[model samples]
Target: MIDPKLASAAETFTLQCVINKRPVSVDVPPAKRLLCILREDLHLTGTKRSCDIGRCGACMVLVDGKPVNSCLTMAYQCQGKNITTIEGLAADGALNRVQKCFLEEGGYQCGYCTPGMIVTVTALLNKNPEPSMAEIEEALSGNLCRCTGYGGIIRSVLKAAEQGGRRHAGRHESA
Candidate 1:
């Protein structure tokens, strides 16, 4: 029932955005989800695609420094925005404090949800460097981790905060 020309136009738009500190340009359909673009097109598979419905928080990414569900975000809407994924959390081959703490604290199991969890926690720490236990729980409410029971994850976030995570809040690029 759609016009052919209109459909073609919608399928051929360009998206220009910075992802993981690198500028990328892709030609994609207007309705393409950012998750698909990141995983399928850009090959940034760090952003997992578990629940396509956006409830599981498996596709979380940072859009302009705010955490968002990439599965619910349209690729077209990402134009001119800066996106950060789990892969961007390191600098010059050094893991950020959050990531290091997660590993040291055993915050992940099976690793299916680690990337999204890390991304969401990173955003929370950036906004509130020293979030209380309730605040950390509230910020991570959307992200689910089945294997770790979340105790270790909470400890990891707390430990990262204690290690001056705020000092490196906005540093998502390699040095």
Candidate 2:
């Protein structure tokens, strides 16, 4: 049996965090994961929640420009930090290079995992613009794709790094 009183009490807290370059303050539970906060509270559904654990990369998001699993991260952990989701990747309706690459390479199938994959790759490329194939595999090691065997995703990322990355190199500084 669930206790409504307890659940409600557990569902509320004071949260102060920066999301997508905007300062936001809201009341949420301390134990609620950032994934929940983003999807439910802030309404940033781009960050998907899968596996309910860190095993799946569907919940990946940028915390201070580094990839982190939102499902395993508590809302409070995002306090006073900058967080970016797939929605933030495109500025003024312009897709980021990584996103463009994903599209060009058909990096998505079901598209459920694309957001997390894109976020993870963007962070990886930000750290190393010219990462080797091995490095690319290593960087994406944390992400899992049930559809493609990573050949297409890796190729897509490489293409993005080589082409659009140059343009983004001068702008859209990582992190």
Candidate 3:
């Protein structure tokens, strides 16, 4: 069953933002988590929900070129912001370089954390292009993945960085 508060919240607020370079408008409650808004309201479920808090990073999204835990962010906070999710990473059905690297490196096992990991790594490579091991670790510190043991995950990111990914620094790139 849907919560009455969520319904009421949806009725009380309206948000306007660009998601994956496309403008989106939603009516939502002020307190609605960005995760819910993305998955439930906007149907962008590529950004998963795990732990329901900021620690998991499962709901990571790019808000104006920075990675943010969407589970902890208010839906209304995204008004007029540029938001990017894992779904937005690809263009014309081609995998982004990070996604491709992750696939080749076997960065994911169960794949539950793949989206968040990709989101973080995408943001990291965008900012650092050629991040050191420590920077990669720091960029991914917020996300938790029990499947890949983080070995293949880090390697995939490093490989992406070595492959012209640095050119995307501080910007969002579509695969």
Candidate 4:
């Protein structure tokens, strides 16, 4: 029932990468998607999987401080990279400013797209603490949210900026 060539065990490779703030090692096939490696292999389910072809931002994750579609990234390519999933956004028990703003602004509804949206916004705000509406829209163009209607999400980003969240841009202040 299995294709011999595709299921060959000879291709397994040990991948070493930093995840969240910790280092992780995994044995995976070269072609295994980073999405599967994170969700299925590592059991970090906060990074959602939708539209595996990479059109949707549901699988977005921060790779070396930049937002990347995990579905489009290969496991081998992640070697020595710093990968941060949604679960990595918060430190200890407290949420980062971005996460707190999302909650206060009602940025999420179904929650499917929230992680990716937050990931993108985090990267954007880190790079530009005071981004304009146009810049925010352009940065979030890849993330699609069907439930929230974008109003709450926009407000969340704006609120995060207005609150002088630069102190907690990529990491919590206490972190």
Best by lDDT: 4
Worst 10-residue lDDT window, candidate 3:
166-175
Off by over 4 Å in 4: 1-10, 165-175
Give lDDT tens digits, candidate 3, residues 65-162: 88999988997788899988898888656788899999999999999888998988888877778798898898889999987789999889889998
Model 4 CA lDDT for position 71: 96
lDDT of each: 0.86, 0.84, 0.86, 0.88
User: Clash pairs of candidate 3?
Assistant: 9-28, 9-29, 10-28, 10-29, 126-169, 126-170
TM-score per prediction, in order, is 0.89, 0.88, 0.89, 0.90
Candidate 4, residue 77: how far the Cα is off, in Å: 0.8
Query: RMSDs, each prediction?
Result: 2.9, 2.8, 3.1, 2.6
| Local accuracy of candidate 4 as per-residue lDDT tens digits, 50-162 | 99988779999999988999999998899999988888888776687788899999999999999899899888888888899999999999999999889999999999888
lDDT per residue for candidate 2 within 42-69, as digits (tens), equals 8888888889879879999999989999
TM-score sort, best first: 4, 1, 3, 2
Clash-forming residue pairs, model 1? none
Q: Global CA lDDT of candidate 1, please?
A: 0.86
Return the lDDT, model 4, position 6.
Answer: 73
